[model samples]
Target: MTMSAHGRPLRGLADLRTLTGRSDTQIPAHKAYLRISFLELEKARRMQEIRTANDRFAVVNARFREIDAEIADILASLNGTAPRAHALEAPHRSAVGLRPVKRQFQISY
Candidate 1:
């Protein structure tokens, strides 16, 4: 089965139903309340999905940084420079890297 961004498979309906407190219930719930509860559950699911994606992104970004540092170390050795002790130090150390982008909106008649 395919895995989710959270490193686990998507939860089955039983798991979702359990979270919604409807898994073991025998009596039927009102249609209106059921609909509202489902909507809220969906919202929670979406939030979890976004959180998982962000977590995955963070892991991938960290791996990329490690790879980049290793490559830089190799390049330094090739150039006959001193072996970089702190090879993982960011290139733009203590630099403000963020710049605001100005957007122009044009309206045509």
Candidate 2:
């Protein structure tokens, strides 16, 4: 391969042919065409990857919103019942086996 003074491979078509050892004159044209097609394929692959990532992000974001709404509903229910829960008294129990058992519920804010 022909190298420039800076030690980089030469960019000329003659240099390309010499590096590849191709006696055929059409190698440069064919290589250029194939390179363009390969670049197009790479571009498509990158776009698909981006699309997949975006779809996953959207799904995860939706799930988070759903969980947040569920949490809000649970909090609202707890707050709503807090006052009524405190006003309710424990139920009286009948004797079982020998002695009566009383059940108590602890309420904490």
Candidate 3:
């Protein structure tokens, strides 16, 4: 027997009809099974999408790190110093030893 993603035996509408013999009592059960199967399929698709998005994010992050290294090399050359490769090894730190600064303004009444 073939199993569905929801762990139920795979059955077509015709198979369900033939098995249930159009009995009213069994109709609801079949409907419930179909609904659950649909929900499980949708959840699996969404989980795959999330996994793809995470992979893309990781690739973009790696490229950004490469760009940071290139910038550091350029800056070091400009400053007449050898690039300090160790300085940029910290994952949380960027090419420059500075964090983004936020400014606040005061409003006058």
lDDT of each: 0.82, 0.83, 0.82
Candidate with best TM-score: 2
Model 1, 5-62: lDDT tens digits are 8996666756654345446545456876898899999999999999999999999999
- How badly does each model clash, as a count of residue pairs? 0, 0, 0
Which residue pairs collide, candidate 3? Answer: none
Give lDDT tens digits, candidate 2, residues 85-105: 456678887666675558677
Question: What's the TM-score of every candidate structure?
Answer: 0.44, 0.50, 0.48
Rank by lDDT (best first): 2, 3, 1
Off by over 4 Å in 1: 1-29, 80-109
The C-alpha stretches of model 3 lying farther than 4 A from their native spots are 1-27, 80-109
C-alpha lDDT of residue 78 in model 2 = 97
Between candidates 1 and 3, name the one with more favorable TM-score: 3
After superposing candidate 2 on the true structure, give the runs of residues whose Cα lies further than 4 Å from its correct spot. Answer: 1-27, 80-109
Error of 3 at 22 (Å): 16
